[model samples]
Target chain A: MTDARRPLQIVDPDDPRIAAYRGIRERDLVRHQKRFIAEGTSVLRVLAGQRRFGIESALILENRFAGVADILGMLPAKTRVYVASSDVIDAIAGFPMHRGVLAVGLRRDDADAAPDTARRWRTVVALSEIANHDNMGAIFRNAAALGADAVLMDAQSCDPLYRKALRVSVGAVLTVPWHRFGHADAMLDWLETNGFALAGLSPRGDAALEHWEPPAKAALVLGTEGPGLPDRVMDRTQTLRIAMANGFDSLNVATSAALVLHHVRNARTGPASG
Target chain B: MTDARRPLQIVDPDDPRIAAYRGIRERDLVRHQKRFIAEGTSVLRVLAGQRRFGIESALILENRFAGVADILGMLPAKTRVYVASSDVIDAIAGFPMHRGVLAVGLRRDDADAAPDTARRWRTVVALSEIANHDNMGAIFRNAAALGADAVLMDAQSCDPLYRKALRVSVGAVLTVPWHRFGHADAMLDWLETNGFALAGLSPRGDAALEHWEPPAKAALVLGTEGPGLPDRVMDRTQTLRIAMANGFDSLNVATSAALVLHHVRNARTGPASG
Candidate 1:
């Protein structure tokens, strides 16, 4: 590759040009304000491939660069790529980043992005008060893998672009189309107005998931672990539950979402479908 | 409650009576050699109720004793309950034990325990090389919640009784019946002899999960992420795949188990069932 297109060598951990990649773990707290840190080679590939997020810069350990040359080669010439020694990289990140691959990407604000209500969707996932980063990431991964067209999280929900969430989602957080909305009430209203059937997963539900069928256009709504969906949200949507065999009803929110999303996706195309 | 049932007071962190509770995060590495630490009130409840495992001792923060009185009352008189200040408990744990409740239980050797081969089990989950404790724990939680009867892991798999696994499993590790066998071949042979139809989850499967129906007695086998089920095992069993959308087939092993288990459970009872 030409010098202009080659990755910039970053020897000093304190280099001002690569300041955006410094103290990643501590800096992650405020990362949602503008940018996201994509870790690991797989996540970085997704980051480079996606159009929704703009790559600001990449910091990679010297040894790992050759292995990821194909991915790095795809980046725009204007995108800065900082190569550093493992020690320098560790010093800048404030913790041992074993993955040795990092990318800072600017998140596209959804405030001006068009809502999915106008488009015909087969399956959509909506979340309320999903504050946990891992759970949020898992939900995005499940949604992306299970054929959900879009994801909508309430304003109170944790950002999917959070570094831990991004890593846990296996970079599905970048691949999946998602938006953050103002209120559960407004999102529910929009779904109904768009001729979409809303089904909320809860222990207390009107129908068992095995018996419930997703409408042609359905939005599966899920909530946080302990409290579940708010009373107002549950009241508006048709509540559905995965029947637990044992007396224990404990399931991680992400697992529950996967079960429900898989069921809804297959229910639409299964042999017994109406 | 009687005096014998009341929790005993232990002021010092170094008290030998509660030695099992000391430096738990580090002690966890070798905890499987003799005892397993069960954390939180919910997990403690499961430990107290189970017959397979025997509680060695319990360490509790003095103030939280009243809340878990019912669970404590169920424990055998022989089981010692040591109560200390939150600070003392934290010091003993080498970290903040925010849950304020813990129990070290002796794992019942499966060699003495009766095998469930004769028992007519509708579903069983088998795992191979699941080194990740959180994934192992999550699988146990899913199996317990979703109606799988038991879990079988290869000897190479991480111990389910590991502390982090126990915590992530929400104590489902205590509730679910599991066994670690010498090799995959031996486990597969035993499963077949027990009349189970083995179905291994893999990206390169013969049939899609949505279309496949579980046999009357089914054993759903799953492997670790990235490097999936071994070719030896996959060659022997019926291979299955969860159809992914957008060509992005990334689902956490635990979430994949949830999807497969949910489908098999529902398929057995759904309208399309035989």
Candidate 2:
């Protein structure tokens, strides 16, 4: 492991070595890339300890490097840390950087390589077409905090590794084991084969969540806010509703995930709403 | 009732009648004003239905008017409706408006005039100092959905009426009765006098939420993320913790509020975590 030391200094914004860091705010460009950007001190710290995702390199503000050198030191010896001035950093991102720390992380894509990703989880969260980055991030955060062992997202769902989602998840995406399925049926088949009971959340559900008892292994499948799960998907899973005070008070998609994930964790471990 | 008629045409962006709508993106000016902006069809719909927060007027895109005129028609007959071209709407906002519907709302400040505000709440969410608008909005949404009768915010907390907060809340702020206390002590005294048992959520809570039975009237006091509630506040309330899988996985402030509020509502109404 590399010990804390002076990081490489990049005085120029157009430095070819830091190509991946340039104009990162360009949404389309960042999306097609195989890697993901991690931002802020909290997320960077989580990335330092996790092995599920590999850290490619780090770009830090000159002043911020000192504050986070200890965290960077924990990465593999091959990990690169590039320190730059605020101007260079802002120019590279195509926007003024709010927090100083940024890093590119390589997705391991280990589900097919290693079945442990699918086999290990007792409590899972399967997301069906979540488009909002904030909601996507919140789902991962809730899953990690409530002890949902794995997170599975459909292909239509936005990338969890997106900078906003990564920061919002507070880097839980790094810690919690996750797999992105190419399609909804693939994810459903995997969950079914893995002995995970599928519980789809909807406005009109077959049973109230508390009233429905979970089996030994369970998966909480969350749908997008407005148009919930498709009939085909709901047909395969037990529809559970979070009964509200009135028809008007619709909970946010992320908020619903937190409530459901908490209930499943309770069923597997201890009390439901602790 | 206007009965969904064609809105008044706005050819120029600099129309003085729409001054409040001009350069609305300027954050500071939006604050310190008695009125607030409500954005998107969802928020506008809620504003139209509620009498507690009075609707001043509305600004809609020429193309988007027909889609939301029914919603706008629900407003009072005196409410002026302005329909502008995309250019004018974009120029007035200083950015391209994603959702065409925007409305100005008047804060009634009727807590003093009407004791019904203080007297009606059986369950309340008291925010200590929430800086994030998204979290603030989500808190209100969860409180409203989970049967929290009122929301109380300390002076330092961000305004729920802020555009992003209102939009993220799905306009729950308009539906849920709320008050902003000038100071922490005032909020504490109000809850105390109103017969609400204060429960401050902390990592090091005195009792697990599930085990601690809530009284008839209870208030869940939430602190800002990172630096949680101050000792002075926690000393007065029963400190509660959301038991997590590990110390590493931290819940978002709003996520914690949802869980705690769900638990409180369950205690008062039915089963916890439903």
Candidate 3:
């Protein structure tokens, strides 16, 4: 086989080709021009595992490149693998990236291509107005760990592809299949049309989470922390709540999502007492 | 009753009486000299509700003081309540004080004052090597929200009373009864002596968390994110796993604690479907 994917030494941090990876925190504030930064070895591995997200280029600290050769080999011959010293890599990213691995992945913008629900999805998550990046990332991590098929978020929700969220997710955000829709009601309606039961997680839910079993196809809905699911959304879906201790009804939304997702996954597969 | 607990208006942010609250973040790095800062209205409420933790003083934004009259009224007559402009409060904190509510609480020093377990506690959580402040805070929040009676962390763990932790926990850190012990084994031994079945959470656990039912008095032990519970500790107790989805065995430590704590709580009180 031809050694086409040799690593390029990046002595200068300001190389124009690697501009997509500069000042990551500030750059993440605006839309990334259809590209997302995947940080750390774990996230890079996930990004390399999938073909849907095209790997445009990778910047790695020289010391860490050897550890990730197998993953790098998975990329196309055109993919630029730029190797730099620790200081150069840190300078490029504008932060101390001790993990020493970063990659830029391109997103597929084809909204018209419908998801193959029958084969690819069964249990899905729908998030409404989840503004916190950490919470959004944690939800993706929980969804991946607990066997949720995909995630659907309304436009109001924070972008799961944001740097901190991607890092917090341990790269699950890169691997998990997720889509964004315009409105909460439209997302719920889409799930309904696709033969999925929409279960909205709320403090004022009518059914206790422990008693609620997932249908063959279920969409677990979560909302922002304090305001929770809007009455309009709650009115359209079956509401469920994790029965908390009487005096303390609050749990971080991510923790709430994990418990709910785990319950749904277990309920569908078998009893909770596996 | 006399208006002896009147709020004192302080224009100077450098007032020595509120020195415990100065440079809050930096002060949190070193120990608070046996004191902790509780932030936000909710934590202040919990601080005021308890007599066990001595309320040394409170600092509030002038605009927010009227909103917390009930909580302020609960403080002892000698407790000083300092009121200042939002800018002064922010400057004093070395950060923006949007919530505009803060209180300094003194932790009880006597380890011999045994916990009133006979009437209040049936379930407890013990943590080993949990160094993350956010994780510690989340665990405290989870413990309080899910009915776990107390938190026992090994000395290696970060302080739960750190400002960020206290804030992240939404003041749950202040409300949850917790203690730090010398070693992991010693804490576990103490739990055993107190009639608790120590269940250590590990990825290599001998039993699946779904099938493992908690005993009447269970102590759920959690470790740090990576290099989970040490084998020495795991060898001494019944170990259990959350049974994550294949290929993804990761969940934030706080989320893991929440799930295990929820399972143990429900198992003891009722079925998982309660």
Candidate 4:
């Protein structure tokens, strides 16, 4: 294929062009190198719909995929694509081919574009060490859906733009703005400085969820499952709990967040519906 | 190893002992055959704690898993416990071993054990074809925690007993009594015969959730993501919309169910606390 007309380049597995798709399952490569893979037509379709997320460096598909040529034609004139035998593509990725399409892109920083009014923000989500990409994505998806204005990740937070996170979010990560706070203390300072009420979601809190009304603009601080929010973080925030009947312990983090966000949103307006 | 106490088995890749865990990714076994997997120490602990769910066979770590052993001790003395090296276990499952424990359980037969009190039930959740195990588990977890009395599943519904579903539910699947309907018509007939009011959750519903004060007992039917409850189902049930801002399309089914369950629970008790 001529370079100008070929938006996608079909290459051999050994081609240096596809290095980004390698060793996705290796923890060290994933953690230290900060790279992952997004495969399949659905992910590509969603990524293409969001141009602002960034450039798609490579496209790998089976040679006979029906509409691969059409998608390649639609890419920005300069975009690079790769076509290979399904076996070759699977060999590079170490997994079976996904519906004959995959793309490699930069892992955008969670703090890529900060919210203008971070200082004035209320009803934010503070994530600490939430390493599971799917959970992180679900939280962002839920946060965006439930009207969370901002997201601040603590030191332990996973890359919000990781392919798994983005795919799980269904591209919501690109739309809902987020940032990172390297230090937990810095997060506390921001919450306090902004005059935001921080509701630390923990089982130890004295008040049941029904007992307290979320402030007009409050921040709901959620931590990873099991250990939950750290004591240091909770110390700076109001300790509130969702009441579970005897025997039950707590709700899933996203489910709990959704409950909290829903109530906080409801609180913004009068209870009785107009 | 003694056969009685050994509970130990070692097999090569070709051994039929690992058949159940094989080919998980190739086929939608959970959908086609109505099967699922339960995993990990947290899950085993939950299942053991809740006496209602049955204990099927299990794979246990031969070393460094005190929690798994503790849970296994609670299983029926006669139940088979296969012991293997962690690496062997990992290879058999096609994924990293989760705290050295996994169980396979039969799907609940809704027709056999649907609570007889459907006629007396006020709050209910009807899940239609929600394929994501995590979502299914989370929704059930939320429903159980939020005080929803019963759960009904349509034909397309994933088996809540599936392993991932159980893990996500924190074993609430066992604690929360549930029933399955053979078809949508069967579910509707049970609801109608029980004199239950149906609230179909959808984006286009005429009634906002805030305006809805679900009666002492009601059924909140939730459709899967994207195309919500079928129109016929919506027509038969009252449309209860969870109001959102302009840009957001809809909440995740699990998230939506949590909101509705909490709302209905609060409404039954009176207004939400501030």
Candidate 5:
């Protein structure tokens, strides 16, 4: 590895090499830059293991590097690693960052990112117009944990690769296959052509989730919290409702999705596989 | 009601009447004051309908007051309602509270807060050492949505009435019966004496969650995210596990709680009740 590409020490917060990492807290820096900031030791480790996305560089506190040097070495030697004091990191980030470890990950392209039809996904989590990053991240985390094969988000939904979303996902976003492109209607048509059952979750559904058995291939669709799936979307898919307490509001979108996915997976393969 | 007790107008940020609402974002003000701050119109509505706790006061932005005046009327005439401009409200809160609705709720006494045996709660959610307010709040929300009768927290758990937890719960904490006092072991003993199955959730448990039939009455206990329920507690209960994909981590504590509670309820009474 070249000297310029090796691990470097950063003393000044205003170092031009780490300019992209500045003002991270003040705005959506990563999304606008077509990259993402992965925080904490665990997320950084995930960024290193995957080749689907590029790990641009990393910034770690001096004391924390000894424990994580092995993980950081996993990244290509060309990936610049900057070690700094806590004060310099806090200054560069525009606030105190307790995690001390941060890395900027380059997102992959959108073309041909859909699931392979040949493999025939058992469960696909479909989310529409999910605006909150926390919910989006939690959905991805649930999709991965409950054994969903892929995660498909409509164009209206927020980016799963958003900094906070990736962090909340506990690095599942790096592992899970997700695509946030194309019209949802087109995606529904594709799923239908693939012989997949499209199950839309709603409070006013025709079938209770408990009674609706999972088919060999299925796409579970969920919408934003307040409005839920629109009329057109609901009409196109079989609606499934989770039983709620008398007149109580619906469960959190991600929570409901977990229950649905867990049930569908268990019903299909039995809980012993869980 | 006296004229002095009527809804009053305040233009100053430092007004002593609204001082308790100030610096809300800075520290754990509500917990220190032995009160909780409820935000948003939806939560305010839930607080208004419940008589278990006392409503001490409210602060609302001038523009948003007209839409909620009727709900405000639901409170007693003596409840102090302070109307303030957006600028003053933001200044007093030390941050912008977009919902424009805030209220201070006085907590009730803990004496005899345990579940009533005569009613025979179908399901109970018992948590151990849950520290995050967001997870804590989500647990209560799930308990309410999935029809868990009450929430019992071990001594190490954080307060559900903390402002952020209350907001995340969507006022479920206000409506749900919860007790934070007493040793977990004693509570487990009481639950067993009352003919309840003590099911402890863990990844390394003996019984798969799907295989374990929901008894007539059950108490489902979960722990925090990383280090799950202590071994001492796990040894005292029947272990139940949610199957995970190969080498994957466990689901969020709150998400798992929702799945368990939803399953227990549906199994006991069937999904038609959902």
Candidate 6:
């Protein structure tokens, strides 16, 4: 094992090697470099551990976080690991701290890999401007766990690799294969062309969730919290409304997605299978 | 209608009017205060739009936001509305911008309400720490939408009314009745005493979610993401594991709650019945 002291490379905030870690603002990364930050020991493990997520860089805290060091040791020796004082790390990230680790990676284009249709893929998720990172991450976590094959977000959605999202997902964001699509129209078009039946989740939808029969392949579309899927989107797909108690409006997008995903997954795979 | 012009309060950060918004450091708010912050028009609208929640205190951005006057005008005359310059508001909140509005509200304690008879309130949620405000908030949102009547949190849980919880919950935290029990033990005891059968969510659980028939009155207890509910808690309750794709470990806590809540609600009420 490469020891912490030997593996550690102390770098100031200005180190060009750590550019990905600097000025970790959402817009700056999205608009300027089209990248975002991922933090925590688990996310790093997921990225370096998984290998196919297209992660481009690594930045680890210099402290005695040997677990983080061990994880970094697994990465290619060429991967840049910047060890920083906790103060410098805080200043660079604009937060008090990360989970004793941080990394900056590319925001893969919204539509990166082509969706695999075969191999028993049944349920998937589509998101609108669900811009809250944590919600996005959680939804991904749910979709992955409920046997959803893919998670597609709209262009306006938050970067799932945002540090908060990574934490909220418990690093599931990295593990799950997620893509970004265009607006409702484009997403609808793609799903239709790809032979995936679509279901829009809406409170006012006439169909109840219990009656929702999952087609052989299905895509569940969820909108932002306040206003659900756009009217145009709902027009294109069958609507499934999760019945709620009176006076209660709706569930979080992620939570709603989970319920829908579970139903769809169950309908496709049969019961008691989870 | 009163014109929007008002004297901006140039009070120090220590001003008691903004006390509710104080100590909002992202981490300290979690560690020390056991809370996090949520700001802006959208979150507040969610809080206000929901009739079940109550207003705490408002920091109105003086004259900056057009079309907001009508909304502010509707507030009760006794409601504390602190008018501040956008700069002061932003500075006090430790953000570059304040979105022209902010409010601080107390965490709702719903546990005080008597748990209705098992037949009347067929579904319940028991949560472990789920300390992330967004997840906590999202869980409440799911519980309400999916027909879970009450939320019980163990000692390690996050403060649901913490601003982030309020925001993520879309103010559902205020509306959803939750109780803080000593821990899972106390919560489980209460559930059993109330004639509620307990279902613990775990990966190692023998009973899959689909296999278990929804009991007339049941409480589903969910633990954190990485570590599902403690073994002791699982030991006390019927362990139910959500089916998932083989590689994926588990759904996010809130999402799991939503899925289970949906199943329980659907089974008890019969879908379309709600």
Write candidate 5's Cα lDDT for B1-274 as tens digits: 3432356898999889987788887656334356678888988888988888778899988889888887887887778899999999999988888989999888767422556632567688888889899999899899889899888887778888888888889889888788764677877877788788899999888888888888888889898778998998899999999887754778999999998987788778766633
lDDT of 6 by residue, A51-161 (tens): 545566666666645667667767665565667778777777766774657766665554254555333556678887888876887787776677677787778888776
Expressed as tens digits, the lDDT of each residue in B65-182 for candidate 6 is 4545555565545556677776777677676554667765433343244445334666778888788876787788787777677787888988776766766676566566667777
The interface root mean square deviation of candidate 6 comes to: 2.2
On residues A1-274, what C-alpha lDDT tens digit does candidate 4 reach at each position? 3352354454567677777776555532354234445555545655555664555465556554456555455556566667677777777777776666676655555425464457556678877778888788888888877778877777788877676777777666766777777777787677767777778888887566766777856878888778988888777788878766457788888778778777887777655363
Query: What DockQ do the predictions score, one after another?
Result: 0.53, 0.55, 0.53, 0.45, 0.64, 0.60
Cα displacement (Å) at residue B83, model 3: 3.8
List ranges where model 5 is wrong by over 4 Å.
Answer: A1-6, A27-32, A110-112, A115-119, B1-6, B27-32, B110-112, B115-119
Model 3, span B19-120: residue lDDT tens: 888898888888535888888898899888876678888898999988999888888888889899998898899989898999888877752125544345
Q: Taking the tens digit of each residue's C-alpha lDDT, what string does model 2 give over A1-274?
A: 4532447888888899788888776752345356779999999999988787888899999988879978987888888889999998998888999798999888765622233545656778899999888888888888778777778888998888888888999998787777778899998998898788899999878888877678778888988889988898999999988878775636888889888877776666676353
Q: CA shift at B123, candidate 3, in angstroms?
A: 1.8
lDDT of 1 by residue, B207-239 (tens): 888878789999999999889999999999999
TM-score of chain A of 4: 0.83
**Considering TM-score, which of the candidate structures 1 and 4 is the better prediction for this target?**
1
- Mark the regions of model 2 whose C-alpha exceeds 4 Å error after superposition: A1-4, A27-32, A109-117, A272-274, B1-4, B28-30, B111-116, B272-274
Instruction: Give the best candidate by DockQ.
Output: 5
TM-score of each: 0.93, 0.95, 0.90, 0.86, 0.94, 0.84
CA-lDDT, candidates in order: 0.83, 0.82, 0.83, 0.71, 0.83, 0.70
Q: Any runs in candidate 6 off by more than 4 Å, and if so which? A: A1-6, A26-28, A31-36, A55-57, A91-94, A104-111, A115-121, A158-167, A170-175, A178-183, B1-57, B64-77, B94-97, B103-111, B114-120
Q: For candidate 6, what is the DockQ?
A: 0.60
lDDT of 5 by residue, A42-124 (tens): 88888888887888899998889887887887888678889999999999999899889999888657422555632657788
**Residue B271 in model 1: shift from native, Å?**
5.6
User: Tens digits of per-residue lDDT for model 4 on B1-274?
Assistant: 2222346575563467656655544433535343445677777777666555555567666774455666667667655667678777778777776567776554544423455755556788877777778888888888888888778888778877766777888877877767777787688778877877888999878788987878656888888888888888888988988876446677788889888888887778764343
